[model samples]
Every structure is written in structure tokens, then in C-alpha cells.
Target: MDWITHDEDVWFDFRGSSPEQLTPGRFYKGTVDGFADFGVFVDLAPGVTGLLHRSELDRRLESLDWESGDTVFVQVKNVRSNGNIDLGWSIRQSESEFRGAHVHDPDGDEDGERIEADDGGPEPVRKTPKGISTESRATNGTESGDELSADATAEQKRVEAEHDETRESEAETVEPAETVSAEPDVVEATTSDESAGVEQSAESHEAEGTPERAAAEDADEGTEAEETAERTEGPAAEPERVTVESLGDRTGDRVRIEGEVVGARQTGGPTIFEVRDETAVVDCAAFVEAGVRAYPEIGEGDVVRLDGEVELRRGELQIETEELTELVDEAADAVEQRLVDALSAKARPETVEPLADHDAVAAVTEQITDAAEAIRAAVLQSRPIVVRHAATADGYVAGAAIERAVLPLIRDEHSRADAEYHFFTRRPLDDPVYGMDAATNDVTRMLQDNERHDEKLPLVVLVGVGGTTDSLDGLGLLGVYDASRVVVDADAVDTEVVEEASVLVSPSLTDTGAADLSTGALGANLAAAVNADVTDDLSHLPAVSYWEDTPEAYRDIAGGVGYDERRTRELREAIALEAYYQSYQDKRELITDLLFEDGGGLAGHVSQQFRKKLDDEVATAKANVEARTVDDVDVAVLDADSYSHRFDFPPTSLLADTLSRRDDSAVTVVYATDELFVRTDADIDVRAVAGAASEAVPEGGVTAVGVRQNRIEFLSGARETVVDAVVDAVVAQI
Candidate 1:
């Protein structure tokens, strides 16, 4: 079969040339020397290389399939005076794609003779062959218009005479039409006749000695070349159809891919469409113009067949789209069904088993299964996951456990290198409540992403939070946007919380022993349930959450995993300290290292800070404690606002717990200006006490913010009255 080739241009072979020999706007054959984040380095000759910048590539830099020593074609875009070379990507990669090929020369264009196609296609422009030197052309007055030395003229004539005899002898045996019909090398041979014809015409012009006549003839030839190029230019050949998973092997080659457009983002230079097929998701970048959207008629959720060149940019695979056509009816149905089948097979875990044998974990096994499946499905569907956990040691461990499990899935499922960061996010909540402030911020960011980038609404997950009455308004706000919500906590949640969340995993619903469960224990088990591949990594996490009375099973698991009592305590203390300083940031890497890696090297240093800070705060509080008795119960009261650092480490709740552990009192009451924390050995209901306090001081606006922590907030003006009411209520209940 006859392949269509470029009519007027010739690809330059730079095997023997230097950098200064390269001509701008001309394509050259080069070897791939290496790769960089910005672009590929191509060597045209020994020590002669140029940078094919990412900006010049049709696709991402990382997507390129070119390896070292592999041949590639690039156009010399510019050669700086400072000896820096800037290369541009060439659409045609092979020498066969060009009508003719030439060996580059520094002095002038040493063109290769062009062969005329006998199939009635446009004839390529004729030029001198490599065998004829520039000195020969100077003797004929065609170059430099200077006369050569007697010896040099005689040498040129003898070489021309020998070349003519060889050309004539070859012409009699090999017909030009037959040569052109054969292989590429035979086609090059056919150019000899044309090369001779051009030489004869040059000599005829020299005999006339009419410079005006030669200039007019050159202009006529230039016009004819333009017409030939216009006639030859048409639609490119159809590219091979391939899958998204196969793009890694087909980089720098044009191909067609069919998939559903899951997301679309408009950048400063191109519109990137994240297309998902049965195998995986790949980003296709289409450019109409700078900052303008491409294929505006096609959007997210549309089934499309796009033709583009696969490219690697910044270590990510991306398609530089040529034509994107939306598939319809039967065509769309076929692709959709294929994707649906794949999603069904890959989105759900085969089975979910609890990490440990505990009644609290067993009580919520089904809920954990559902939550894990939901998370997995979200990843397969390309929906972002937003995990909001309480900003505490247990909360960070809980969030980090899920992060560790989900990130590998994201990397495996998505073709983009940065999918892990883009698909999953862990944000820490200031308190163990997904309140309106947090919900409002989440809504604002998600809405902006959806509006600006056409991104899918994210799955909002609440860990160690959102299992209380205080989070109802926040959960409700997310529900209004139709965002999926999952709540996981160890604390006993309000009954209303169960109805508000999409999925609730709390042992408190079915087991009275839920109070012994820490959010970290639930989180680690849930993470294992989400991705069982990471079960071994989560073995020690449950032990890290419990400060005083860790369960024997979890403690054994920690020891088995090489985390002894000291190491476990160090990790716990380190995470708690780090969690306080940047309560809102996930600090995923630092926390991961402390919890799962570093072998106690990092944890040792940070835990020291934690112990020092807490010990100092506890020492200060012990000096100011006021000992009293209420209803035959020993009580110790400390004005936390006066005794503790309000905005510093060892928060009021932690301080109160520490003091209660050290005191002989039956109840410890740490009262701040507007809030109070109650710690007791008695089985008194904290929420009931908060209710009684609110009733006794009806005008104080007293409320229970965290029943699990026995935390209450009241009007600052009624602090004195609210404290007495709370203490009396606690004593009465005991």
C-alpha cells in the first residue's frame, strides 16, 4: 500500500552534524538521551542535544514511551546565541513519513533529491543530491557567484563527469517509476535523475548569465511548492483504537480511546477531561485556544470517542486530544455496560472481617462492612473522599488509618500519578463535632470545585465526630447538597445521629461496653475492612489510642507488630502533641511515620515534649485545687481559666482527666470562664447533670457539648451559678 507523505518538506538526518548546523522549522532525527520532569532530552549528534519542553509536547512528560537510545523526530524550534537549543515535538516520527530525507550541513542546505510519484500524486520539490558538493555549485556560478581556483575547478569537473557516467549507467537499468514503487531506499535512488535534471537547468541559467531570469524562476518554484503542499494536506490516517490501561505503552503515538467523561477541568492552556473506561481513568487534554474550553458540547458523564496522542507530562499520562466525538444510542450503551460490569467487580471488597475479637467491634460488623464498601465504591466511581475527624490523638490515628488504606487503592485504580492526593482528603476538626462551621467550609469548597471544574460531589466522612446532637445541623447541611455521609465513632451517639448519617458505625448502638472502645480502635478495624490488604499495617493502631487501659488483644497485637509498651506510649504521646499544634491539618506523612514507621526514633523526641507539657500543666493545676464535700462525696474544684494555659498544650479536658487520675476525690470539676469539664469515678450521667445545670440557671444558656467527655458550656456571666448547679447535680446522681 502507498502511504501518504509530506509533499514539500524533507526530514534532516543529523547523525554527522553539530548544533549550529540545525535549521529552525526543519525536522531532525534524534535519539532520546534522557527524561526530566519538564521534558525529554534528545541528542541530535554527539554532544549536540536539545530540550523538548513539556509545554511543547502534546501530552504530559511522564506519559512518553521513549527510552534512552530510542530514535525520535523533533523540529529545531530555536537555537539561542548562548548555545541553548529549544526543540518542538514533531507529528511525524519516522523518515518514511517525509517525501525525502537529507543530511544536514552547516554551510548551506545539502538537500536530498526528491522522487516524483508515478501514482499521479503531487511531485516533491527537486534539490541537489548529497554527492554534489557546494564547491561544484560555486564553479557553476549558482552559489556565492565566485570563481574557483584552477585546480579546484578541474577537481569539480572530474567528480561531476564521474557522477554523470554513474547516473546514466544506472538510469538505463532502473526505471524511475519502478524505483518509486519499491522500498524507501529504492525511492531515494529514483531521485538521481531529478538531481541531474536540476543540475542541467542550473548550468543553462549560468550560460545565459541572466541573474533576473534565475530569481524569477526560483519564485515560480516557491509558488508551485506552496500549491503542492496545499493539495497534499488533508485528513490524517485513523489512529489505532486502544484502552486507557494501554496508554502507557503507546505514548507519543496517535490513538483513539472510548470512555465516559467523569470530570472536566479548564486550565490556563487546555481543558482536561478525566475519562474513565473499564480498566482505569486517564486525563485527556483538549485545547481550542489558550484559556478556552475545547469540545464545549461534550461534558461530564458523556460517552465519548476521542482521538489523540498519548503524552507524559510531569510524570503523569495525558492525552493531547485531536478530535473528541460524543457517542450516542447503541454505541454509548455498549461502553456504559462495559464500565458498569467492571465497576461491580472492582468496587466491593470480597469480604469484611473485624480485625479483633471484641464485643464492641462485633456489635457493628455489618455497619463497618457497609461503610467500607461505600468508601471503595466512591474510589471506583472517581468521587472524592473528605474525611473529617476530631483533632486528637485517637482522631488523627483514625483518619490516618483510613488514609493509609485508601491511598494505595487510589494509586492502583487511577492512571494519574497524583490521584491519591486529588481523590482523598483528611481534614481535622477542632472538636469532636461536625458542626455548622466545619460543614459550611466543606460546602463552600465542594461547591466551588463543582462549579469551576465540574467535579463530582465528594463523600463526606466523619470519624470520631458527627455522632452527637451537636453535629445534626452540620450533617443536615451536607445532606441538603445530596452529598453522601458516613459517621464512625466509638462513643454512644444520640439516636437522632443514626438517622442523619448515611452509614453509622458505633458499637454503642448494640453493646453497653462501647465506652471502652476508642475511635482509633474502630478506625483501624474499619480501615482494615475498607482495604484488607493493609490489615497487617493496622495491627498496632488500636493500642496507640488507649492511654490508660488498653485491651489485652490490642496490646498483644501491638507487641506482635514490634510496638512494645514504651514504643506504643511514645507513638501515642507524639501523635497527641502533633495533633494539638496543627489541629486542622491532616499531617498525614508525619503521623504515618510516627504510627507505622520510624521505629520509635521520631516518636521518642516528640513524646518527650508531650510529657513535659502535660506534667507542667498538671503541677500548676494541683497547687490551686479547692477541696470540698458535697452530699458525702469528695470533690476537687479548680478554676481552670486561672490555673491553666487557655490556648496552649494540654487542653482543659486533658488537664482535668490528669488531675482526676491523681486525686482521691470522687468527682473533679475543672471550670473555665464559659465551659466546665467534669471527671468522676461515679456512674453519674453527664448529660443529665448538664440538663439540671441548665434548669437551675435557666438564664445561663447552659448546654452539654460533649457528653462522652462530660463537657458543658454555659453563659460566662452565670459561671459561678452554673458550676454550683453542675457539682450539685453530679453529687445527687452519684
Candidate 2:
């Protein structure tokens, strides 16, 4: 038979019990000492230990099967100057796996002798361990004839005598290993050789009378016995499993939990796994190395069994994981079923009633319920939610109401402290239509996140937008990727959007009176349906959405919530101003503070800036207003590009709305270089006017951008012609 030799097929046995006797790059037998947060400590010899970091392990640190005092195989990677040993994992776990072995004597020879292969294989390499005593290696045939001093020889003799005495005492105690159990302080050794070695080491310690060493030894022996029993007698009884919701009571107690992993994130110190059970969600922390993922095989959506100790970290419950095992077959199915049943019961509200009694709100109650359930389900599944709303006071209030309701649910449903920011987002749209520009950006981001982080595509909630024909293309783009879209708009919606949207809540689609309806009112009710716990906080949002003719019921609700008429007005104006400045940003914290906190102090300060900016813009436009009479109707036209601050506060549409309020009977048309805004009290279809203008001036490329806001865009070269045609079209409709 032929034999082969490999580096890993060799093992080292160090006879001396000292740190200096260990050699790097050699495989050695070690006893498991204990565990730590980062790694396990292994003892090569008595008082000589090495650290096998979790990063060096082939599996998660918590998944290691070795127990204290059990023999483990490890490779010495390095020996630091400070006497610290860094160890690496070895595949071979038993002495029988090695083809050759070496016995290292620290006091005998410079190069330790290697034992020959058991079955006549190639000779193994010879390597010396460190710390060879010069006094023991000194020879009489030396050329220099150097001799040891009297003091050195005397010290060596004394050390040898002590060693002999300690060995003799250990031999005497070897037979009575089982008798040591009577003393609670000392542990019984597993074998005679181990018993002698432990006794000799323990007697050398100054604190020999203490039971600490014995206790440690006993734990190792007990673990070995238990493992042996498990192999021969089926398996040991499992620990009691606990639910995530019950973790608070089990703080500092090691527990076994079964759950679905909703999310996983790698932080600076540990990899955090957000586990969701039937009752609730909790964060389980598994550390391998700084910034390194703990278990690459485990990921979101996996059903797993986790063993960990519960701890309260920074006022939040966290589990420090000891072992994480993925479940499959029947076990996984059972856990997944439990989570599904709980999620279905908790995600949808039992009833979704309108916040206030209005015919339009009542008509869309079912649709609102569906939208709310979808949003709630998204949260429970750990899916990201992206809310797109118009950049106006009413739009901000609509989006903010939903934000206020969903944030708390996110915090409650996820263990990560930053889950609210990660799972929920509100983006302001410059235009009310969910156009291709916005859709492309959203799809790009979602795809990147899905590819890089393994995240689910977000639930795109279109508030006060995505309910018209103009948004059909954009909504269709999202549908191509199977992204969920919920449209909640108070404005008239095209019948086509009903098919494109996953859930549509619009008064016009239900054929009800929407004159009294505001997007904020619809959004607030939907928010309440999503989370009824925050219903009190959202009662005032509808009142804030309106600039005029605030409903009596909404006003009462606002007043009941301590937001009187004056305070509501101040908040609306403040949000309107802030909304215009950073039209694209959510400004989540600032808006939350103004709407739900600070008791009107920040709103008051911000409202002042709103008034000053609006007054200045209106003043500048009033001086250059051009008046015209089309078919006996008073029409006020302003060259917004030349007369108004084009890039500043008071956007063209907002300026037109404000200027139209000056004469409710007259029509206000604000025309920029390539676009126009129309504001009037008369019933006029802006899209109709744009269509008529496009026909009147075919080369101008006139088109209606937003019918709700009454905005039109045209080619700049035909700006003069397009403006005249738009004015004529508006007059004909009036």
C-alpha cells in the first residue's frame, strides 16, 4: 500500500506547559477553555491559551459544537510579542486523522524529534518549539568549553526538584479521580493522564485551596458525558422555546427561539438579524468580526432556530446569538405557517370607517380599506414603502398624515433602531402626475437595492397624484416590474387609472361629490385604517389641508385636538413655504416637528417667512398685470417670466391661484417662457383648453401637464402664439 503526507496531516504535542513552548504554523491539540463575545479560548497546555476568533472559523461562532475542556484541533497562526496566541480553525478534529505526530520537549533539544509514520510513510519534517533551556542543551564537547555559573546550576537543580515533587504528588492522586467529586470545589478529571496533569498544575497555583479550577474541570467533564450520552441515547431534551414578545421577561437568560428572518443588516460591530415570530419582532446580533457578515448562508425570509441570551441594549431588547440554525422541511413550514396566520390577523383593520361624515369619503370607504390593508401588509413583510405626493401644502399634509401613522408601526414591527428610515420614505413630486421621470428613478433605486442588499421592491403609494391619464404610462412602468402601487387622490381621476392602480381611492371614480373632499382628508382616514393607534394625532390634518371653506366636522376635530383655526392656518402656511423651498425632499423630521410637535412655536416662526416671501412676490406681479376682456369676461394675464421672480418663492401655479383670489369672478393666467398656469372660480377643464390651444396652434406643441393644478406646457419658439391660443381657449370654456 502507498502512503501520502500533507502539512495538515501532522499534529504537534507540546510536553512543556508554557507559552514559549508553542510554535506557529503547526497544528496542535487544544482544550476548549471558554467562550467570549468575539471568539473561543483554547488551551494548548496548562496556563498557555490561544484565541480562535470567530472570523477564523468555518461557521458562525455560535454554531461551534466544542464545549469547555473538550479537545479541539487548531492551527497556531501567530504568537504576539505580548504572549498572546492567535489560532485558526482545522478541518481534522481527531488524532487518528493525522499521518504523523511529533513530541516537542522545551528543555531537551533544539529541534524536537518527529515520531515515524505508523504505516511506513515518508519521514515527516522536524521543527523545534521555542524556549529550549541553554543549561539542558549544553555539551562537554563544545570548542569554547563554556560552563554554567554556580548560581545558574543551583537554580536549575531547584527547579528540577520541584517538578519531581509535583509529579509524584500528581501520581498519588491519579487513582482517586472519582473521589474528587465529593469536594464541590474540585472537578474530576476524565482520564488518569489528564487527572495527573490537572492536579500537578492546580497544586502549583498560589490559590490552591480555591475550587475555581476544579469547578472548571468538572464542567468540561460533564459536557463530555452529556455529548456521549446524546450520541448513544438519541438526543438530549431541547431548551424551552420562547416568543419574541416574551423576550423582555427573559433578559439575560439563554433562550431558544424560532422565527422568520425579516431582515438582515451588517453594522460596524455585528451583523443584525431582524427575526419575526408569531407575536413580535426582535433583533438578534451575531458577531464574527468588525464589519463582517456573521452567517453568509442565513438571510431574509429564512426560517431559523436561534439560541441566544436576551439583553436590553440602549432601552431596546436585543438577543446576543449563541447558535443559529436554518430550518427546513416540516419545521420551516410550521414556523412559516404560524407567522402567516398572525400576520393576516394583524395586518388588516377589521373596519375602516370614514374619519368624517362626507358623501365623497363614504363613497370611497372600501377602496380606502384596501389601500390601508396593503400598506399595513407591506410593513409586516418588511417591504420598503415609497410615498410620492405633490409638493404643495395639501399634498404635504396628505403625505405627512400617512408618515405619522406608519413610522410608529415600523418601529414596533422591526428590531433595528433605524428601521423607520430604512423601510418608509416620502418623496415630494414637482408635478402632480406620476410621470416617467419619477417612475424611472424609483425603479432604478429599487432594482439596485434588490440586487445589492436583497431587499424587496418597495410599495409605491401615490398620494394626491397618479390618478389621471397623464400618470398611466408611469404607473404602467411600475406594473412591468410587478411593484405595488396605491393611488389616493381627491381630484378627478381618469377611468383608465382604475385598471392601472393596485388600489385606487378617489371620489371622482366613485361618482360622488368631491367638492368638499381634500387629499389630506382621504390620506388621514387611510392612515387611521393603517394604524388606529395614531388616529388622535391625525384628526387635524384634513382641516390643515384646506385653505378655505374648511368643513365644520374637520374644524371641530382639529379644535378637539387643540389645533384651533389660527394654529391650523399657521401650520398650513409654514408647511406650504417649506414645501416650496425643497420641493423634492421629504424633510421628514422638520415636517413631523411642525405638524405633531413643538406646540405651534416652529410653525409660527416659519409662517412669518411664508407671509414675507408671498407678499413680496405678489407685490412684484401686481404692478405688471396686463388686463384683457375676452367675450365680456375679465381676464388678467401676467408675463410671469418677465414680471415675477421665476426661480424664487410662489411657483407659477401657486401665484396664479393666489392672484385669482383677488377677483373671484375673473380668470388669472400666468404665462412663463414655455408653460402657463390658469386659476379661476369658474368651472373650466384645463385639459380641454390645452387641447383647443393645440389645435389652434398646431406647431406650438401645447399640452396640459396637470389638470388638477391647471398647468400647460408648450414649445418655446411658439410661446407668443401658444399664449394667445391658451387665453382664447380659457375664455371659450368659461
Candidate 3:
């Protein structure tokens, strides 16, 4: 094998130019010279034979349809000394798909496929491959259910491996399986003698991966995606090859084209239809209107070689072909084209819907949440469900209780948080909530006098409720209180509440009794769900769980969140996020209500307990509100308006967008769930006018009203109930 110091700027040791130097990404059509369980080897020219995997042999379809002498188009992948080459194939019977198939040459943009990203894109064209991308199916596998699914799960990602911009670095750092490049650095295998004294290949796995395990991990959602990292190969590997030469109307040079056959004449017309490259696809009319030339029989997955000038016919990439060849390299190429056609034929690219790409964390969170939701749904649907929530006791914290109540419905073990207090207390509760009362005047007074705020302002939010110690019921109010305190603490903490802190109002049994967490909250049925849109802030926070009960539990993880059942932990996190969302949204509304309204912020107020406060500090507040009809509402509302929030962060917004805010100042959603009851020392019949929502919010939906604020409270119910109520509330008149 000697280097060819010939006219070509290519280098070769012996078995032809490398995969990098192959033209049109294909060597040429060859015949099967050998067959093995692994694949069928095809002889291209003389010294080269390409491989067609056994996997490519259609089991359900007719094998007789394909013969040894069958002329196929193929692109050369790896060139083995023994003349073994990897052949790409497709069983698609479509003429166009057959004509356009090519190998994995990076020179031009004959890419693999597009993925279902979370970021919404315009609807796609091909509708065949459900949950599959047009781009990927177009260039990879066949779009049958079994094959498509398998492809999604096992196909190797071949793009330039680089995290997309959507990969938010500031997000929780996840150990990436393959972060360096698309093609993992090759490692040579070493042989070792085992028990039988037989030689075995030992592939010392790298620090972050094992192909099997990694593959499984990626397949969790059927598809793993990386941005299209350009790696040019094939004839177009060099930009010079992509150029087309218009040689005196006959033989052209440097022309690269991709397309499907619309019409192939056994003798006359040039293949009709189109040829697509990187930027755009072009419609090319064949030049052989001459004597019946082999009908230019271009089948699907066959790469049409355009040896003539590239004429842009009405904005289309129309190439006149002097030669026609099949892209018979890796069988994957043909499969991909057929898959694309099937997908496109199944539907149009415009119809394929774009999906939102979930980040690792978001994905994990979504899975967990979806599992929880599934459990909740099954229980409520299949079986009789009475979602439980408590006034004070019963058995559960906002996150943990819901997790327990619905655990039975879930077949997967990952839905549970694994531990109660530890995980739930991450953003724990604190401070005994003390409010004036939800009266119009008090809310108004509180809103106007933004400063001199006391623990007894119209609303006082308790953060994280502590974890359960003894019986679940005993952990109710106190637990809610503890958890509440934990949630409100402005600073991050790392301790779990060992006392009866993780309690909450059981959504299950309206019965206000201690809880029984050990039973997993079954039997008595459960209650409703908390809102995910709320933004209530937390206070007196406790520490979160740092370590799990077992060490080996998390052996499979790279960054264990202190447990082996990482999936379970993920589910817990998702629930917590939803709860947090509800609480946050609730808080935002409370603030908006307290600070606005034409009737004057807090247009109504009649809290007996707060009345005492009014009597106690009425003078100080009146003095504050007296100024400017006083823009107390404007002042208080404006003070905190500088911040932006998100249940869904805006894509265009900066990453630093705040989830919670206080500015060391005005209003905040410090804990809205009844996990911790915000109480007023004084009890009284408080009738407060909370805008027009007063009607929409049924007396029952308003679980616990603020002892002081005009319209602050907790609202929870069955998923459907809450979803409907929320939708209605949001769609309410401006």
C-alpha cells in the first residue's frame, strides 16, 4: 500500500482513498461477494466489497425481490483491507426516494434528521414518522413503527457534538455522557484471557460512558438530539467538489446533487422532479430527451449523479445528470431516505408539529411530573378517587402528601420522593404567619404603606413546613408551619425539619386529623391538588435532605442527588416545582390585587382581628395613605414591578430572570399553600371584596383566606376541577 503521488490532492495507503476522500459519498454499485450473520458483503469495483447488514434483510418482506446480481447504489464508509465496505440500503419502493439516497458524507448538507425540540418550530411536512423528525427520518432509517422506534432508540448521533444554546449552563450541572465530539475518540481494544483461558476483547470503558448503558439512558425518550454539527465528507467533503462545471453543455464537473425520481424513462426523458443539497432543493429536468436512455430508472435511496451544469430552474436546484448511481453505502442511508419519504408521504413536512425541547433538568422534571400526573389520572379515572387535602392535619406536606396519595397508581417506583422531610424541605417553610385579615381597608392600608411592614401585614407567609416525626396527623399544622417557615427563608438552607414540620392540610380527607404516611395515604382516599401557577414565597426555612439512607442506592448515577432512586427523586422534584408554581401564581395575584383596583387597593375590609391592628396602628397607616389619595397602591405596586417572573421563562429573556423577589423590600409570594396556615391572632368574620373573581372562586375553592390580606388564600381541587377553574379565572374579563 503506497501513497498515490498522482494528480489528485488525495492521500491513500492502499485500499482506495479514505472514507473522507470517497466521491459523492459513494464508491460505486457493487455485488455481494460474501454473506455472514452480520451482513452481506458486496464487491464494488475489484478490490472493494461493501457490507449490507443482516439487519437490512427484510424479514417480513420478500427476500427474493433482491438478488445477488441486483445493481444497487452505495456510498463507501470504512474500507477494509479484505475489501469489506459498509453499505447503506433502503426497502422503500418509491422511485424518488431510491434516486436521492446518499451516504453520510459531510461535504454537503445531506443531514440525518430534525428532532422534536421543546422550542416550537413551524409545523413539519412529513407526517409518517410520529414523534419523529422529518430531517432525521429523511436521512436515516425506515419509518415503520418497529424500525422507526428502534432507530430512534439505537441510532448513533453523528453530528458535530456540541451542546445547543438551549443547553443552559447555569442550570443544574448534569454530567454529560458524550460532551467532546460526535464521533467518540476511538480506543483500541486489548485482549485478555478469561476463565476458559480464551482470548477476549476488553474495551476499557471511559470515565463517563458504557455504550450499552449510555444508549439505554439516551433511549429514555426514544430520541437523543445534538445540534447539526457540520462534518463534511463524500465527494462534497471539499467545498470545491460542491461546485458545478458547465462544460460546453455536455459533460459537467464538480457537480453535487440530491433528489428523488418523479419520472424515469427507459429510453427518453431526463429524470424529472428535483435535486436538493444544503441551502435548498431544486427541480431538475433530465437532458436525455434523446434515444430511450435506460429510462434513467432512479429508484428511491439511489443517489443521482449530476455530471452536467446546475441550472437554477425557477429557484430550484436543477442539475442535468450524465451519470446515475445508487447511494448504496451504509444501509442506513437508503433506510433514511425511505423513512423520510414514508414520513413525508405519511404527511407533509408542514404538518409535522414542532415540539418543545426539554433540558435535562426539565426533562427529568417532566417525567417525574408526568408520572405523578399519570398516577393521579389513573386513580381518579380508573378507580374512585377523592383527592385528599387537610385544613391542618391528615398526613402530608404539599409535595410529599400528594406524592403519597397517588403513589399506588404508579407502577414505577420513581414517583415517590424516597424520603419525606429531606427532599420536601429544600425550600422549607418558616415564621408563624400572622396577618391583619383579608379586609378591603386593611389590604389597602397595607398596600399603601409599603414601608414599616410588620409580621402582621395583611398577609404573612410561612415557608417550609418541617418533616413528619411520629404520626402523620401529629405532623399537620405544625408540619405545615415548619415547612412554611422553611419556604419563606430568603437564604438557601441545607437542613431538614426533624420536628412535626412537614405537615399540610390534607387534600384527601377533609377530615382534620393527624396523618398516616406509612400506609402511603391509601384507604381513606385523597383530596385535591394545589395550583402550579402560584408564586407564594417561603420563610423560616429548614434544611433539605443531603444524603439518602443507602449509599449504593445511587451507584449508577454520576451526580446523585443523595439517593439511588434518581428517577424517584426526579418525580419528587417535579411535584415540588408544580406546587411552587401554584404558590407563586397565587402570590402574584394577591400582590396585584393588593396593589391595584380602581375602587382603591383593598376596597373592602372587615377583619375583626385586623380591626384591633387597625386600632393599634391605624394612625401610622392613615398617615401613609393620606398622601396623594395617596398613591399607596401605585407606590407599593411600582416598588416591586421592576422584576420579571416565569412559570415558563421567555426564550428571549436573560437567564438571570428571578424566580422569586423581595428586593429586600416590598411584596412577595412567600408561601401560598396551606402546608402552613397563615393565621391572624384575632379571629373574626372577614368579608373582603377581592375584585370580580369573587364570583368565579366558589366559596369551596377558597380553602383558606388570608387572616389579613384582602383576597389572599389557597385553592386546590381535582386536576380537572382546578384546571377548569384556573382557565376560567385567567380568561376572565380584563
Candidate 2 Cα lDDT to native: 0.75
Comparing 2 and 3 on TM-score, the stronger one:
2
- CA lDDT, every prediction? 0.74, 0.75, 0.27
lDDT of 3 by residue, 24-57 (tens): 3342444433222123444444323345543444
Which ten contiguous residues of candidate 1 have the minimum total lDDT?
199-208
Question: Mind sharing the TM-score for model 3?
Answer: 0.19
Using TM-score, rank the candidates from best to worst: 2, 1, 3
Taking every candidate in turn, the Cα RMSD to the unseen true structure, in Å, is 17.5, 18.2, 28.3
- Candidate 1 residue lDDT tens string, 1-734: 64454523666766443556677888877766444333455667654667676567774343455655567788988775534467889876665666666666555455443344223222232343212223323445333334655554453345346434532110011111111111111011122322211100000001011122222223234344445655797545566667676666666887777789887765423457878877667777664322245678889999988777776644456676666788889878988998888776776677777777778998888889889888988988878999999888888889999998999988866656678888899999877888899999999999998887677899998998899888999999999999999999898788999888998898888845597899999999999988899999999899999988999889998899898899889998999899888788888888878887786779999999999999999999999999989989999999989998999998888889889999999999999999999999788778799889888999988899866678899999999999999999999998
Task: Please provide, for model 2 over 1-734, each residue's C-alpha lDDT reduced to its tens digit, 9 standing for 90 to 100.
Answer: 53555556788766665666687888987766545424566767654666676557785443455545466779988765545567899987766678767776687673446765444322232322111223333445553324644553454345336434531111001111111111111111223331111100110111111122222223234344445666899742344577666665666776777888877875423457878777666777665433346678999889988876666543456776656788889878988998888777877789986777878888888888889888998997879999999999999999999999899888875545788999999999999889999999999999999999889999999998898898989999999999999999998888999899998888887667588889988889899889889999898999999989999999998999899999999999999999998799999999999999858889999999988988888888888898889899888889998988889888888888788876543788899989999888789998899999999999999999887788999999999889889889988987
Candidate 3: segments with Cα more than 4 A from true spot = 1-397, 400-679, 684-734
Two-way lDDT contest, 1 vs 2, winner: 2
Query: What TM-scores do the predictions have?
Result: 0.65, 0.66, 0.19
